[model samples]
Target: MGAEGGLRERKKLQTRAALADAALRLALEKGPDNVTVEEIAEAADVSVRTFFNYFPHKEHAILGRNPEHLERALDRMRTAPAEESPLTTMWFVVQDVLRDLESDGQLSRRGELIMSSPTLLYQLMMSSFDDERQLTAALAIRMGEPAGSVRTALIVSAAGAACRVAMDLHKNAPDRPVVELVREGFQLLAHGIDPAFDQRGIS
Candidate 1:
């Protein structure tokens, strides 16, 4: 019975992802303004009602507003070794999340769409603020700090900023692996900004 329940949940998630992917693909080919919910449903081979069940509207579908991924990241954080530093655990969680996203191939397409559409990019940035809040809360819980503590907030904010910078670098250098860029971004955080500055003139 438990296995059956889990399988059913997985099917639901797959269906939701399919719908979102279809919407994104269509939006990429034809502008978001021209893509309708019905067309998205048709592309995904699901009924319009099913599409609505997964997303409130076309915009949400295009943005892929699923919180399950974030929840899974939090679960990874919770399971990380107690002795690991919060930054280390959080970075590991980010890598896991990005690896899964990169494997899906949808992330690169979404980045392209976001870059091409000013409105979509603005909406994505707004949605990221919500993601940051959720991540900050999860990190605080893992560190045993109060949900809204300053330390957690600052750490999460810094991490978020680092990721944004890494993503921008990835956008510019699509040939390079995003995870590698992300690691470099974190190294900047760990080693201090402009690590080469002191030796620049001497060499």
Candidate 2:
């Protein structure tokens, strides 16, 4: 909380970001499974031991962006209007922030690679709970409720479901824009998913 603590956290964050960026580049240059921890550490300008200090394993380095992005979303959510519902603000802010990431066609290509690869897909989905925990805490404070309250639970559940739905839709229609998938996912969450399906079938 103090300046010293803040400095330490920021420095750690920088190291983590660097490590993930290096890993991503390596994965694209070669392949995710082909890239080694030492390679990523060297690319990050750190020793392999120091890499372990930031991430437990090579896969952790590959998946580290999820937590980093969630942290950014929390910072943005903290600035939401006080009068607005926390669930709504958090949802919109997260989507908006991720939309920026999705807009980068290159990064989305990385995402597509990760999603298509059977090994990374399972790990990414499994590790996503870490992000959900941070989101639940942020929403709880904003909603003036306990972290595990029904509202918080519902919001987290719905938001997570929407994200998965969007990803699945994106996988099916790789040519479609990510924003369109996200928009359609949110619409299904707002109304009934059945209606979206029915309309799509009619189209």
Candidate 3:
């Protein structure tokens, strides 16, 4: 039964991957404004309704595309032993994922496109905070803290800002490992450098 369940999950991931790829390809081919869910569905070889099952809307197909990345990251983080702090666990998981991506060369083209596309940049920002909330909430639970507590707030804020900094460095430090940057950013936050992060836009 576990094997069967794993197969089903794998199939779902494959379908989701196909849908996101189709949507991104179409958006690049034409323009983000002109593309529709129906168009992405056709490109993905899935029906429009089936597309909605995987994604709520077209803009989200690209912005919310990296679902697996976060899930896998958090899964590894959540397994840390009692000796490890939540922040430390999160740092390891984030760095591990970034290292894997760097090895696979998955960050260059797609991230470049998203950063350069003004429309997609707005969409990514809008969705990014909301996604951070979910991950932080899960980590908070593991930390035995109430949701949205001051501790959680600090961690989440630091994580969010650190992510923005790391992402902005994508174009400049294309050769550097994202994991190294992320790990260093988290270390800075952990070592009482929160106020030094220059929190202009982060709430």
Candidate 4:
């Protein structure tokens, strides 16, 4: 029964990914506003009812209905080595996630589609806020801090900002490695941003 359940879950995930990929491709080929849920369903070879079962709307299809990547990151943190710090575990997970996104190629296309549509970009930002909240909670748990505490909130916010900067840099320098840029971004965070402080030998 457990094996059967696992197979069922995998099938559901595959279907969901197909719908999302179809939605993104159609949105990029046509405009987001021009693409309909029916078109996405047709492209994915799924019924409109099945599409609705996976996503509430077309925007959800493009942005994704769940935070599966964030969940995976949390799982990684949970299983990290005992000696590893929360930040170290975070960097490991971030690097892995960024590498996966870079390899997928769909992420770049999704970014382009979002950038072209103000509405989609706004929706993406709103969805990202929810993701940030989830990450903050997960980081807090990993660090043995109280969830929703100011310290964890600040740490998560800083890390998220650094990653965003790295992604922007990657967009401009597509030839460069995203993981390298992500590492550099975290290094800047660890080293402090102010040149004067570094000169003063502040740790």
Q: Which candidate number would show the highest TM-score if scored against the true structure?
A: 1
Q: By TM-score, how accurate is candidate 3?
A: 0.73
Candidates in order, TM-scores: namely 0.82, 0.70, 0.73, 0.80
In the range 3-61, model 3's lDDT, one tens digit per residue, is: 99999999887788778777777777887778999888998888999888888788778
Estimate every model's Cα lDDT from 0 to 1.
0.79, 0.72, 0.72, 0.76
Task: Put down candidate 4 lDDT per residue, 1-203, tens digits, no spaces.
Answer: 99999999999988988898898888878889999999999999999999998888899897654556778877886788878866677687677766655654666566556666887877867776777688778777777888669977776667767666655666677676656776887888777676575455545
Candidate 4 all-Cα RMSD: 3.5
**Clash number by candidate, in order:** 0, 0, 0, 0
Residues 41-90 of candidate 1 have per-residue lDDT tens digits of 99999999998888878888897777676787678777878898777876
lDDT (Cα, tens digit) per residue for candidate 2, span 15-57: 9878878887788788889999999999999999999888877
Largest lDDT belongs to which candidate?
Answer: 1
What is the lDDT for 41 in model 2?
A: 98
> Where is the poorest 10-residue window by lDDT in model 2?
100-109
Candidate 3 or 4, higher lDDT? 4
Model 3 has an lDDT value of 0.72
- Candidate 2 pairs with clashing backbones: none
